[model samples]
Target: MHPLPAILIDGLRATLFRHPRVSATTVGAGMFVAVVVVYLFASILLEMAGTSPPWMLLPGGVLTVLGDSMLTLIAAWLLAVLAARREAVWGIATVLLAATVAAAVVVHWPLGELASYLVLHEHAGLAILVELVARCWWFFVLLVFAHWLAPRGLGHALGSAVLAYAVSAAAWWWLPQSPLVRTMPVVQATAEPTSGDQDGDAKTATEQDEADDDDAPGAKSEFDAEAAMYAQPALLDAALARLKPQTPGKVDLYVVAFAGDAQQDVFRNEAEYVETLFAQRFGAAGRTVVLENNAATVTTRPLASWTNLQRTLATIARTMDPAEDVLLLYFTTHGSDDHQLLVDLDPLPLNQIGPDDIADALKTTPAMRWKVIVVNACYSGGFVDALRDDSTMVMTSARADRTSFGCGADSDITYFGKAFLAEALNRTTSLREAFDLARTSVDAWETADQKDAKPDAKGVAGVEPIQHSEPQIATSASIEAKLAAWRRTLHESAAVPFAPAGEAMSRGASPSPDASTRSGKG
Candidate 1:
C-alpha cells in the first residue's frame, strides 16, 4: 500500500482501539469540514454541467450550498453528540462496533428511492415513508451505536432515537429562511419590450383568418372534445378560422390547464371551474382551453404531450391581439426539485415543463404583453425566479422546498387554487388582492394543519409538520399598473354569478363560438 494510505489506516485503527473520548468540539469540527467538502464538490459539479443559471453561480448558488452544508453539519453533529454520550456510559470499542453495524444497515436502506420520491412528490404513502426516514435516519444510526455502547435495550434505544431526531428536525425547521434561495425582482425598465418594435404581419394575418371563419360552410354544432388534445395543423387552422379582429384596448383572457396525473381529478375540476368563471367574467366563452389527461368521457380536450401545449400557446398568442390581451395561465400538477412542473396522463408519454420552457414560450409571444401565471403545485416558487419579467405576474402554491396540500383525487381543488382562483377571484376584482387573500388563507390552513400534526412510528397521520406549503407571489412594477387596468375592465364587465351553495360548476357544457373569442375574433 502507499505510505499515505497506510498511515491513514493506522490512524483510524489507533483511534478505534484506544477508545479515546471524542470531544464535542472535535466532532463538530470534523462534521463541519466533511459538510463543507461535500457541498463544495456538489457546487463544482453544478458549475461543470453548465446548466445552472447565471444567478446561481454568484450569491444565490453560493448561499444555497452554504445553507445545505449547515443543515448537513447540524444533523451530523447531533448524531455525534448522541454517540459520545453513549460512549461515556460504556466504552469507545462498543460505539465503534455499533457504528459499523449501523453503516451496514444504512447501506441496505432504500435511499435512492427515497430521494426520487422526494423530488417527484408522488405516491403519497411512499412519500410519508421517505419523509420519516430522511428526517431521522441519522438518529437511527446513532441510536444503534448508543445502544451498544450503553447496553440499552432496543425499546430504550428507539425512544432516545426519536427524541434526538425530533430535536434536530425542530432545529432545522426553525432555521431562518435562506437568503440564497429567494425571489429575484424583474427590472421593468430593461425587461419590457419597446412599443416601436414590430416583428411581422402575423397580427394582420390572424385578423383576416378570423373574419373568414365567421362564414364557414360547416362547423361542429357542439364540441365533441376528446382525450387527445394535440394540435393537428388542419384542426389548428379550423380553430383559428373563426377568430375576429380584437377590439382596441380589450383585455381578453386566455386560460391553459396544465394537468399532471398525480392529482388528475382535482386538476381537471379546477381547470373547468376557472374556465367557467373567466368565460362569464370576461365574456370570453370561446377563449379558454382545458388541456387535461383524466380518464373522463369528453369534457376536456386531451393534451397529448408537451408539443401540444406549446402549439396551443403559440396558436393563442398568434390569434389574439397580444398587445391588448391578458393571458391567465393556470398550471396545476406535481413539481420536481429540479424546477420541472410535471405534466402527465399516463401510458402516453408527456414531457415535463421547466421554468425555461415557460419563459421561452412567453418570449416568443412578445405581443401578449400582460400575463398572470398561477402555478399550483409543490416547489412551484422556483418558477417565479425564472419567469418573472416586466409584463408578468407569477404566483406559486409553495416555495421550492415545500409541498402544497389538498391535491388528492378526492379534493376539489389545491389549497392555492381554491383560495386564489375559485374563492378570492370571485370575491375580489383585483388579481393582486386575490393573491394576497389566497396567500393568507393558505398560511392559516397550513398553520392549523401543522398544529394538529402528530408524529408516529411511520410519520404524522392526516398532517405533516414539514409539508406546509409556503405560497409565493412575484409581480413586476409595470404589471401592477397593467393589472390595475385589467381589474377595472373585469369589474365593468357583466360578472358571473357565484356557483350555487353546495355545488360547483357543471362538469360539462356546450362548446363556445371559437377558441379566439377571447381575442374578439369571431
Candidate 2:
C-alpha cells in the first residue's frame, strides 16, 4: 500500500473514534507535525474545490489554519493547568493533537470531497448543510477526547469538553472557508464576440479550452452561464409586459405556463403546445406568459424559477380584476419523491418550487380569486393538499405516491400533459369535464401499454399489468361557476391540434402563431 494511505488508515484505527486509542503519554513533536500535515491536506481539498469557479486560496489562509492549531494547543494548556497541575500538560496536548490528526483524515476525506462535488454543481446550500453536520461530528470527537485527557477523578472532564468545543467552533467557522479561500465572482464580460472581434473571439476560445482542461467541470461554461443570467432580467420583463389587460365585465382568464427540467425537451414542448391551446381555443390570446427552463429558451423565454413565477403571477393578478379573473397555471416537469418540481437550468442557481410555494405566491397577490392549477408531473398529487382551497381547482398528474410516465428524451409530451392539456382542455373549457375525460384516457392508455409491454431480456415473466398512476383532482364549487361563466365568453373555435413541441415550434425560437383554428386539426 502507498505510505500516505497506510499512515492515514493507521490514524483512523487509533484515534478516529469517540474514545481514542492513544495513551495520555508525552506530547511528541511528531504528533504536532502530523496534525499540521493533516490540516494542510484538508485545506488543499477545500481550496481546490473552491477554485473550480471553484474556490481559490485567499491570502493568509495558512494563517487561519495556524491560528486554529494555536487554539487547540492553548486549549490543551488551559485544561492541563486546571486539572493536572502542569504535570500532565504534554500528555493532554498529545491527546488533543492525536484527536485532531485522526478527525481531519477521516471527516474531510470522503465526506469533504462529497460536499465539494455538490458545490461543483452549484449546490452550495447542500454543501453548507453538510458542513453543519460535519461540525457536529467534529464537536463530538473533541468532547470525547477531552474527557480522556482531563485529570482523572476530578470530574472536570465535562468542563474540559465544553472548552474543547471552543476549539471546535474555531475550526468550524474557518475550516471550509478559513482565512483560506472564496468562490470566484461571476463576470458579465463573456458575451459572444461580434464580427469585428473575430481575432479576440479566437483568443478567448483558446483561453476557454485551456481553462476547461485545467480546472474542474464547474469552471467550464461559467462565462456562458453568467451571460445567460445577465440576460434574464430583460427576458422576464418582456414576458411580463406582453400580458394584456383584462376585458371589462368579463371573467378574464390569464395563463402562466411553466416548463421545468431542461434536460428533457418534453416539458418545454408540452408547455408551448398548451400555450397555443389556451390562446386559440380558450380565447386567452395576449393573456398568457410562458416560463420555460430550456437551453434554447434561456435568452428568449424567462426561466421557470420560483422567483420568476411569483413575479409573473403578481403581474397577472394586477392586470386582471381580483374579483372575477381566473388564472390557469400549467406546470410540466419531473417530480422528486418528495414532490418538488425540478426547476433546473444548469450552472444557474434557480430555486426549486415545492408544494408550499404555490400557496405562498397566491397569497402575495390575492388577486386571482379563482384559479385552475394543473401539475403534470410524477407524484404531483401531493400538491393538492397544500394548494387546494374553496376558490381554487387543483389537478395533478398522479397520486402522491405514484409515478407518471411519457416524459423523456424521446417523448414529446407526458401522458398526463397530453390527456389533460392537449386532449381534454382542447375539447372543452370546463375544467371539471376536461379532467374526467383526461383521467379516463390516461387510465386506458396506461392499461393498454402495460398489457403490450415486453418482459426483460431474461424473459422470466409473462404478460402482466403495471400499477396505475391514479390521477387526482380537487375541484372548487365557486371556481367551477366562474369557469363556466368565462367559457360563455370564449369565441367559437376548433379543437387545437396535438403536435409535439418539435413539430409545432422550432428549437431556440418561439412558436410562429396559433395554427389550431383550422377545422378537424385535432
Candidate 3:
C-alpha cells in the first residue's frame, strides 16, 4: 500500500515486461517479472554449485533449487517491505541476507538427504528431471514470452534479471555458515531440579540484582570512593581555602550551564557539581551564583533569546565592582563550528554564539581585575581568541575540529568537567596543573571510544599586579598573592609584543601583550 512498495512492485513489473515498455501499464509489469525470474535463476545456480551427485543428483538438486528460490524470494520481499517502511536500506539488506541464509540452512540439508535417498532407492530422478524441464523451459520461458509480448520490450526485464543475479551471487558467496547450518540444535540441556532449585534460584536472583545495581543512578558512588570524596563539600572548601588570601572579603563566583536539549542531562549534572565546588570553595565569605537550566533564578539569562544574554551581560557590567579582587566564570554547553558556544534555543542552530558576542561582553567589563573563565565545551579553545585579556585566564575543553565526549543524555557529567573539578578539588593542584590533568583524563576516556578529546589553555601573558594606592598592603604575602605571582610568571614566559590599532588592523593579527608588564589599573 505504501509508495515504496508500490514503486518496487512497479519497477519489477516494468522490468519483467508484463506491459509495454512505452505503455504505462506494461512498464510496471515488466520490472516485477524481471526481478522474480533473475532471483530464481541465481538461487538454482547457487544450490547446484553447492551439491552434486550421480545417485542423489537429479531430485536432490531440483528440490534444493526450489527451496533456495523460495527463500531468496522471501528475503527479497522482506527487504522491499523494510524499504516501504522507511528503514535504512543497507541495514535491511544485511538483515535480509542473514534471514535468507538461516532459512536456506534449515530447509536444504534435510530435504537434500531425503531427495538423495529417494533418487538412489526408487529412481525418483526421472520425475524430478521432468518437473525441472517443465518449470524452466515451459513455465518460466512462457512467463518471459508473455512479458515480452506486452507493448513494452523485454530489454528492461533482461537488465533487471542481470542485476538480480549479481546481487544474489554476491550474497551467496558472503553468507557465513551459522548455527542453523548444523542439523541438530547446539543448545545444551541443563539438568532440572525437582522442587530443590534453591541454588539456581539464588544465582538468578543475584544476577538480576547486579544488573539492577548497574542500571541504578549513582551506582558508581559505591565503587568510586575517590569520586565520592572529590564531590564532598569539605574537600572543595579545603581546596579553595588553601588558595584564598588570609584577608579575603568576597570572591565573586559566577556559574552558568546551558544544556541545549533536554537530552543533555550530563551537562546539567556537571554544572551542578561545579556549582557545589564553587560554593564549597568560595561560599564561606564570598558571593556565589549558580545558573543552571532548571534553576528558578539565574544570573546568566536564558539563551532562548540572544537579547536576554545581552541584557544579562549589561546587568553584570553595571553591578560588578571594578576593583573586585577575583572573578570566576564557568560555562558548560554544546559548541558549534569554529569553536562558537551553542545556546539551547527552541530551534537550535549549530555554533550559535560567535566570538564577537563574547568579545563584546568582555569589553563591557573592562574594569574587572583578575578574571578567570573556564569553558567546558567542544572546540572551546576559540574562546581564547575572544575573551583573552591581560587580566583574564581562559581554559578550554578542546581545540577546533575535535569533539569532546562523555556528555550523553544518560551520562551524569562530561569527562572533561568531572576530571577537571575532581583533580582541582582533591589534588591541591594549581589551575594550570588541573587543566593538564583534566586534558589527560579526557584524552584517555575519549581514546577508549576511538575519539580524540583534548583541552588547552591560553592567555598566560600580559598579567601584572593590581596597582592599588596601598602598594604595601597589596604586596602582602598570601595564597592569592602567590597564585597571582605564578600567573604573572606564566604570562611573562608567554608574552609577545602588543601592536596598536593601526598596525593590528593592517596586519589582521591577534592582539599579543607582555602579560607580566600589563597594568591592572585602568
Taking all chains together, each candidate's TM-score versus the true structure is 0.50, 0.55, 0.37
Q: What is the lDDT of residue 314 in candidate 2?
A: 72
Ordered list by TM-score, greatest first: 2, 1, 3
Clashes of each: 7, 4, 30
lDDT of candidate 2 over 56-86, digit per residue (tens): 4556567666656666667767776656547
lDDT of each: 0.51, 0.65, 0.38
Question: Per-residue CA lDDT of candidate 3, range 1-522, in tens?
Answer: 543344444333332323212322222333434434443344444344432221112233334433444444444444334224323333222222322332233333334444434432333454355323322321222234233432244654344333433344334333321110101111112223212111111111113123222332322222233433233333223322223232334434333333432224454456545544544543322333333332211112132222333334333433444234445666766554344454432222212444554543443322344556776665566667667654566777766434455554355666677677755444532566666677677666554443231333663323222111110001112324434453442211211222222243366532211111000000
lDDT of 1 by residue, 1-522 (tens): 542233223223322332223432323243334434443444444333323333332354455445544443344444445555522322222223223222222421234345433433324345445545544444554465445434557876566556544543344443422222212212112122112111110112122123223222211123323323433333444444444445566766677666654224566667666767777765556776665545441232445234556556666766775655777888876565455665544334455667866764553222356688988876688899887766778989888766677764346677788788777877777888888999999889877766676777777464324445778889877778766776666645544443421245353454433322000000
* Most accurate candidate by lDDT: 2
Can you rank all candidates by lDDT, best first? 2, 1, 3
Per-residue error (Å), model 3, residue 500? 48
Q: Backbone clash tally for model 3?
A: 30
Name the better of 1 and 2 by TM-score: 2
The segments of candidate 2 whose C-alpha lies over 4 angstroms from its true place after superposition are: 1-223, 462-465, 506-522
